[model samples]
Target: MSTATLPRTRSRSRVQAPKNPRDYVRIGLWIALAIVMVIWAMPMVFVFLTSIKSEADIFSTSSFAIPGAPEWQNYAEALATGNLMTAGGNSLLIALVKVPVGLFIAAAAAFALSRIRFKYDTLILGAFALGSMVPIQVALGPLFKTILDMGLLNNPLGVILPYIGFGLPMQVFILHGFFTQVPKEIDESVRVDGGGNLRLFLQFILPLSKPALAALFILDFVATWNEYAIALVILQNKASQTVPLAIQSFQSQFTSSYGPLNAFTIMSILPVLIIYLLFQRYFVQGMFTGAVKG
Candidate 1:
């Protein structure tokens, strides 16, 4: 056979290679994932398109239509009118303070639960697991009264304290699961080296659990930043409001101003997007590793 004919034959054989069921399954998953992503992104796309349009254009045109004249000033108007910067700062402060402190507390609790054998350890872990399932709404009434009695209403601490409490169960559960996967030999070695539990936890376990901690930090920060119900109850004043409460107030104030409303909505989520992007590399790995056991 001619060399050209041999090349053609080889190409044909490659093209005609048999497909595996697994290959088909993988392709199907990719297609499904793409569809799911598009479905999820549609609303954000609509919001973004609306954000850039003139007020008149928003009502006159289709939801997804590009603005004929992009209204860049909408962002400026939103920022000034909505007081979103102040609210965002409040949210950021709460997140930065709450996430680290909550994580530290959770890590300590998780270490005790996973590493130390004590009476009622199983019961305590079970309680935390059950606590994770309890709705925040269930405790809202009593929580409000407690905050009120303490004169913490409209204070950041009111929100921060509750956020920490609500966050602990899930954080402890995730960290405990991850900590259990750490080899017992390391714990034994640390003990043999005359290291106390605090030293082992602070130096060894924490260093080893960076991925899980990063994942929890991102998740917790986002939750705290976006939380509204508890914040609404605790932070009644405009100055103390977080992003979600501020957005609600902004929407109320700008009932007819669609452009500014959409602009504010987009801006409110930017911090969360930044945070997720920063830790996304660790998110899936941490979730899977921690979830594997619990």
Candidate 2:
């Protein structure tokens, strides 16, 4: 009986705030980046999956399928059968010696080109630019002959010498761009302090150029480590073979053993990956800075 005069209540609806145009662009960029990352990572994921799978599992199941039981022995087999230890050691030594020596030579050349104005500087720089564009294949015959003549064939120096030669033009180009960005005042101040070119270069320029140097070091090291064509030509001796050559030999030797081959590949990639991860911060900065500054 008391329900005669009950009031009706209106329900309130929630209204959403309008999205900014920038929000959509940000979301689009993030989605694009995610897709790119997935695309890039797919091959690596498959390689890893294959590396741990049994030979039967690799062929029997889907490419992306997880293995029922991981064949951990694949790694051991790869290393032992490939003689990868000695190959890896040779690669490490080549990279260690080549990278620093190459960088120093490149830096010095860059310093000369960027600083001390001299006759034919532009012409010389043009020549280096020309040199960088020359394909390695074009020089292989002459390179091989020269190495043979020098008795450096089957020697690490054979590979090292060529690597340094090929690597220089690009390294010098990058370092020169970066070195030019250094203020003239710094060079003047160093000279005012009675510092010669060597002191200025060693004490000031090199320290200031660390980002560019680190970037070049990582790139040159990886390139040197993974180099195959030059290494194949120079390092004929099994004892002197680098990782890439050894991996090629391993593949040939173990044609049907996909598991161990994949494992060996993954192992070989680890050093370059580690080097990149260690110095990744400087890479982007150095590249963009060198590019944009000049």
Candidate 3:
């Protein structure tokens, strides 16, 4: 072979590495995924690490360095320590008891807005929607003062009332859209079969809208559970404080202990995390179903 031809032959025979578009795309995707995973997981990892560190070690050690020994006692103390159990109980009451009431009222309003051609439907629904956009702090002071007048201050219902107010708008918006998408044939058939509005809503609409309602239920629960400002303003007695309040107890005016504080924060957030994971699919589907046109 000619010398130049020999060089060309070697180039043709050389088993080159993959440089195809698909292979390059896959590599880029994995690198992007790893970066994203690290970014998201970093906060959670820090919370967990702080939860397990002793106060002395937490103060002395570099924030980036992992603790030599994990302090499981912080979690125990948080659970068994002062006032936390009571605050946790209060949180449960507000989240569990108030969520159903909020859902029912909001769903009813949505149903009325979507299904009824009442004279005041537009006015009333718009009012509720408008209420959701105002910052909570804007109204909370006056709301609490009014609650005090009603003598419901330091009561579970006081916090619950505000929760319902704030939660209603988003709920109504989601549900009205969902109800609009329901086939009119179902309403006609129900009416033809001697069903009134009440029966129609109860038997058909409620069943059909369960997923949307479930999603709202979880959303409201988390909001109420984590709410601190309204709860602090309303609940004068520590006895009525909720989970966020309980977690706040970890920090003091003079000093905050990171180990116990982070531990308690982790403990407080764990239930919500668990609940979200368990019902994530339903939560996501309900939200999308409510938002999207059929």
lDDT tens digits, residue span 1-294, model 2: 556877889899988776844588889999999999999999999999999999899889999999989999999999888978899999999999999999999999999999989999999998888899998998889999999999999899888988999999998987888888888899899889888889889998999988889889898998999899999988998999999998999999999999999999999988899999998988766766645534
* Model 3: pairs clashing at backbone N, Cα or C within 3 Å: none
Better of 2 and 3 by TM-score: 2
Q: Residues 1-294, candidate 1, lDDT per residue (tens digit)?
A: 655544444344446555643588889999999999999999999999999999789888899999778999999999888879899999999999999999999999999999999999999999999999999998999999999999999888999999999999999988998898899999899999999999999899999999999889988988898898899889988888899998899988889999899999999999999999989988877777745544
Q: In candidate 2, how many clashes are counted?
A: 0
Q: Rank the candidates by lDDT, best first.
A: 1, 2, 3
Task: Name the lDDT of candidate 2.
Answer: 0.91
Please give the distance, in angstroms, between residue 164's alpha carbon in candidate 3 and its true position after superposition: 1.1
Question: Could you tell me which 10 consecutive residues in candidate 2 have the lowest summed lDDT?
Answer: 285-294
- Give candidate 1 misplaced runs (Cα > 4 Å): 1-22, 290-294
On the 0 to 100 scale, the lDDT of residue 126 in model 3 is: 84
